[model samples]
Target chain A: MLLKDTISAALEGLKRSRMRSMLTTLGIVIGVGSVVLMVSIGASFERFIVDQVESFSGDTFEIHAKGVQDIGKDVLSITFGDLEAIRGLTTVKNIAPAIFLTDRAKYGREEIAPMILGTTKEIFYNWSMKIDEGRLLSDEDDKGAKSVVVLGSQAAEDLFQNENPLGKRITIGARKFTVVGILETMGSPLTAELDSMVYVPFLVAKAIKGRTTYIDYIALQSINGDNELTRQDIVSLLRQRHNIDNPEDDIDKDDFYARSMEQAMEIIETVTMSITLFLGLIASISLLVGGVGIMNIMLVSVTERTKEIGLRKAVGARRRDILIQFLLEAIVLTLIGGIVGVIGAISFGYLISLIASKFLGDLTYALSVQAIILPLVTAVAIGLIFGIYPARKAAALQPIEAMGYE
Target chain B: MPENDAPLIETKNLQKSYFNEELETPVLFNIDLTIKKNEFVAIMGPSGSGKSTLMHILGFLDHHTGGEYLFQGQLAHEMDEDTLSRIRATRVSFVFQAFNLLPRASVEQNVMLPLIYHPTIPESERAERVAKAIETVGLTHRKNNLSNQLSGGEKQRTAIARALVTEPDIIFADEPTGNLDSVSGIQVMSALQELNEAGHTIILVTHEKSTAEHAERIIELFDGRITKDTTEFKTRKAKEEDSLQK
Candidate 1:
């Protein structure tokens, strides 16, 4: 009975001062909204990283020289013979050796300098590169060193705006080659940069370089099993083939190094996780400040309503009744703020997602269920935390003194 | 009626005091008093004479230190605050001097508040009782108005209706007309007189002679002790009864 009376009375009390109540509610709304938005943005960033990693299949590995700083820093590299040997191994399913070189690319009047990559057709499947129009290079093309090339998604756009580059001949580094295909847009800043490169047969690129036998990198995939063992077997076999006596000292002496796609995935997860934690810590402070505001106003309210407290007690309201009224009033106030904050957060997340997609190309603002719920829970807990002092003060007023108060 | 009906309220050598760290100040000295059921008793005193304190103790709104108070033949001085609260809830109600009606509450809400605490009365019956109380106070027309919006007389009437809504045994009004104009004061006193005529016990505390004159019996206090007790105003209720007998 007291709960019903007090709660209704509390609502009435708020209604009596609509402007003040609204102002108080605004504090919590901003606090909770920022927190939810921060959390959702964090989730979206994590999703963005995961999507980036997923584009390069999880079963693939990249082989390159250890501690190579630039294009020409490391002399130790992979040869075509070594690539054939790694393919012959039991654990190896597919291999593609590619050498990266930067040269002036030109088709008709358009000209720009971008990386020129030469590899077999296996790289198209290994890197999940989708061809826009025509077929990729065939095995016979790689063996015969055919002067046919595939354009990167960006390179095709820059070199051939509206015109079809497929079957059209273009000059790539003093050699004339027919464009066979163009890779679809990847949209990642890093992967998109890689997409700007032109792809050709391995022999064609080597012949252009005049007796270039060794390549800078080899990408490979393992048979359907644990890839860690496959990675280890590949490393030990390379050491044996290279005639390295001490394999443990390979970090300093060894010519080559290999990493699976899983290691890169782990790095992305850890970095994003820490970023979320740091941002979340900063956002929680606003909630604390909002709670403090509630506490401050409630204390003032208790003091101001001393006579009312006395009057209610004189007419038969118990301490618990007064306490429940003020406490529930505080809870109701924050709950209103919480609901408004959730809507504000979602709208903000959508707006932010739109803005981000403009520049980053399809980066989402993830508004997960957990992200929405945390701010609401924080709001209630804050109400409960900050509401106790004032309610208790109101409840403990003596009827005689309060009644006599002017 | 027999003359020997037990007193509805009996206080023997009732005393109240306030204490600081080093000294104790007594407010109400030794006093013995009895009020019967359906009595219209007014207590008058100068400032600091403890008339309001006595009324507060009698109305169960305050505690009287070092006293033996018998309320309806039950020893009440030793009762806990909760028990006192229960008595205040059902049997005793107060009307404060400042017209202490909740300013934010409408006249109807103010009147219904006391009944909200009455456990045995269902919620549905409270509205009817509140309406009746407002009618008795002649403020039924102002029931929807907030107390802050009402005139001084209307506010006091709403306070009285709040006192009356629970159907309490005793209505202890502490200077109900103190904050009102002479015209509003008279209207408020007559409302009390009307309630008294309906057989409800009315205990009033005031310093105004005209207000005290409305009661059947008046008691004057000097320095926390009763100096005079009189029945000078019996003619008003008695003459009305005599005319009714005609």
Candidate 2:
């Protein structure tokens, strides 16, 4: 029989039982929709994390006390000595040692807890930090030992009540420091709480707290070319200075740990992407169930249309022709469902991103091609895998017995 | 017609049996028969007498358990399933007692089915043949009507049109008018008779004496064996002329 005639006849069969066909297709729709939406959400979350990581300076790395009990514990053992030794290396462009102290600050009795960070002037350049108002801490300020502070945007708002806070005095654990600059909003970091912090000169902060041989963390930048080599050099130099054989072993010792931002980003990306794909794979179970649904319905359809099969066979339809007709119906049904699910997922992703950005301040919604194509191709494959048995069964039916079936 | 030449349909020592697991019940005994080109014949028997079974074997819808069956000198047993289907499509057509029209199909589409199976006919010419078949069956006014909407005789006529559209060498009618009233039965028999007289060979299986009376020859079967084969004595010339007028 002609292909057009066969297809038209199949369509006629579907039309004759419209409600049944629609119900069968609805199972596929839900199956495809759930899979696509789940993967889209997972992908969006991964993009959110990647965007947060990329917001940091890609060329920088962080150094902290190895074997530190906790990141919040007294890791002040890293001092200017380590920073100077790191700077002596040929591949080291700039190094900044950071000391963090938490204290209550009062501005007209609006008291709030905020972090106070003490670092050199070069930290602004190395870390890509921006100042929204006034000026950043200058090298002259670091050299002359001035008592000046930079307020994070949130801290500035909390203390100054929308007034320009630059040049204003803010008390930090009893010593008053002048607000030399107000830092721009950095939004939320993937791993840090940066909104409620204050920055001050390293020497001044040490003097105010009477601290010696203590530093919180250090930021390092490499000179042009071979960042891996530079990172190795810095690690070796720190290891030698701290008298540690293995940096990993130093995690329990009072040694120092150094790592490039690229390494950290790679680790973070691997973890986040693994999580996304894990969730995507979990959602694929539903897609598999949807495929089985197609198979089940097709089997039922083959049974219900036994008489039709008999008629076609009686009219000289080949087994392959019967097989192809049923297979094509299944594939077409799934592919159409896949398309609808994709469209739904894209629109839903957009809606979610719009809502997220409103609360999260311009976070981008990622549209991954794999997220779209994987589910569609998976749906088609599911149809084929599940459709084969029913097609074969229909094809194998004897013309005499099938015609005799009620 | 000389018996030496190849008949349109021929069977030798044809035997068919049904196995119900315990016993082999033979439905067609060791029978031999020959149908010439364009001869209108009917096989008559009561229910379970093997007339329908013989029609199925003749139409190539079923295989004989032990037999030498030939269509236009080609051995039936040697043909594969695909080849048998091709023969059914191009060389023979069937009209069932229930009219077995695809109920969802329109009258014209039902008539067009057999031509659809004929690979030699161009699609354009198939449409022309379908139109001509429907016209010959006197269903031109109902060409667009679904088979379910057709009356008993109209449905049977549609079946006849479908059988005729392929322009096959023979038409197998297994009680084509079994479900119709006397008037509808007469109308269907007249259509079949006309087709036969127009040089299409027809082999009908019927229990109704009146329906078999319309044919030029009647072969009687009893208990899976042929009992009588004879030419019609009464109304022979009138029936022949009626068949010829079409």
Candidate 3:
């Protein structure tokens, strides 16, 4: 028989039992929908993380002392000497040692607790923070050991509440400090941690802690953004300064580790991709069940149409022709399901991106072409794999026997 | 005359049997028959007389266990499945007692079915051929009606149009009027007789004496064997009978 006629005939058969055909394709619809949904959400999540990571300066590296409290803090601390030695490197653009403390602040009768980040004036150039109200900490403040501070936008709002915080005095633990600047609002995943912090000169914060405070972390900016070379120089200088005698290859023996912003982005991308593929694998089980449903209905169809099959054979349809007709029917059914699923997932993804962008920064959620094509191909393969047995049974029927079947 | 040519169909020592778990029950025994082109022949017998079995073997719908069956001077009984299917598609067609029209399809679509399987028929000519076949059976008015919605006589005429659409060398009708009322039966028989008169070779299987008398020749079977063969000089005209009944 001509392929055109076979296709029309298969369509006619399906149209005869419209409700059953729809119900039979439901499993495939759900399976393909979930797979495409996973891909869309995964791509959107990766883009969100990339946006958050790029919001900060990518040329900077953070070196944190590992196991400082487990080992003695003094033995594992990243100290002032290590920070000054790194600052002397030719590739270093800027460097600062930071100390972090959380304490309550008081201005007249109003009181608020804020995270206190203590670092030098050069720390502004290493991070991408901008001033909203007043000037940042000056080098004179560090040299004079002045009790001066900069307030994050949210901290300023909580402490002063519509009142100008610049030039205002606030008490931090046992010291009084003058607020010199207020940072702009940072809309990010780390907004709670960064946007509520008050910045003070590093030396003053150390004095507040009675001079036992070791540098909590060192932030370094690489000149020309060459993080690889700058990171190698910093790691070797710190290892040598701490007197670790292990070979250069013994990374586990190092007391401090440095991570660049670019490396963190790559790690996030890899983790999100793994989650997408694992969810896709789980979605395929529903596709398997869908295939079984197709086979079962096709079997019922073949039995119910025994007389029709006999008539077709009598009109000169060969075994292969009958096989092709039934297989084409199965494939057409799955292709419809695949198309519906792809459209549903794409619309759903767009809806989610629209709603989620209100809270997170602009998220670019685009479904890749591979995500669409692969699921459609899988749907076709499932049809073929599950369609064979019923097609063969229809093909092997003897005309006389089949016609006489009640 | 055309009588010098080979007969369109022939059988010698034809035999058939049904086997179930090593038990063989013979249905036809030592049957010999010959039919020429443009012959309207009826095989007549009561149920269980094996007349239907003989028609099935002749139509290539079933295989005879023992036979020398020739179609157009070729060994038809020994033909493979592909060859038989090719013959079925182009050289022969059948109309069953059930009408066998696709219930969900229109009469036009039902008649177009055999042409769908015809290997050499150009797609451009299919609709024209289907129209011509439906016109021949006098069913052009109801061509767009679904077969299930038609009366018994209309359905049988649609089946006849399906069989004729292929323009096969031979047409087989198996108890074509068995399910119809007398008026509808005469209408169907008249259609078959008119096709026969138009120089088409037709083989009909029927137990009704009146239905068999519409054919030019009759072969009677008794207990799986041919008991009599006769050529009637004046065959009953189904159109005249249909008018008389009306």
Which candidate ranks first by TM-score, i.e. highest? Answer: 2
Which is the leading candidate under DockQ?
Answer: 3
Q: Candidate 3 docking category? A: medium
> What would the TM-scores of all predictions be?
0.89, 0.93, 0.90
Misplaced by over 4 Å in model 2 are A66-72, A76-79, A188-192, A246-257, B1-5, B20-23, B233-246
Model 1 residue runs over 4 Å out of place are: A63-72, A75-92, A188-190, A203-215, A225-263, B1-8, B21-23, B73-78, B229-236, B242-246
The sequence of per-residue lDDT tens digits that candidate 1 reaches over residues B1-246 is 123456889999999998899689999998799999899999998889899989988887778888788887777866776777778788888888887887778999889887766766888898899889999888878889988899888888899989888887799999898899999998888888777888789999999887898898998998999988897777367868888999
**Per-residue C-alpha lDDT of model 3 across residues A1-406, encoded as one tens digit per residue:** 7789999988888888889989888877887888888888888888788777777688878887885334223434677777777778897766777777768888888888877877887777667778888888888988888889998888888889989999999998878999999988876764556788889998887777566636777777888778888778877788788888767557688878776777767788899888888888888788888889999999999999999999988888888888888888788888888888888889998899988887786777868899889988999898888889999999999888888889
| Residue lDDT tens for model 1, A1-406 | 4567778888987787778778888888988888888888888888888888888888888887765447744455666667777888898776888877778989899998988888888888778888888888879889999999988888998999999889999998888999988888777864887678889998887787666667788887888756788888887777777877764745456678776777677778888878886777788798888888888888877777788889888888877778888898788878888889889988988898889888887787787887888889989889888998999988888898876776
* Sequence-dependent TM-score of model 1: 0.89
- The collision pairs in model 1 are none
Tell me how each candidate scores on DockQ against the true complex: 0.59, 0.55, 0.68
Query: Residues B1-246, candidate 2, lDDT per residue (tens digit)?
Result: 123467788889989998897799889998898889988899999999999989988887778899789877778899898897788778788888877777677998788877766767888898789899999989899999999999999999999998999888889999998999999998999899889878899898999898898887899999999999987533445655778997
Interface RMSD of 2: 1.7
Query: In model 3 chain A, which range of ten residues has the least summed lDDT?
Result: A67-76
- DockQ of structure 3: 0.68
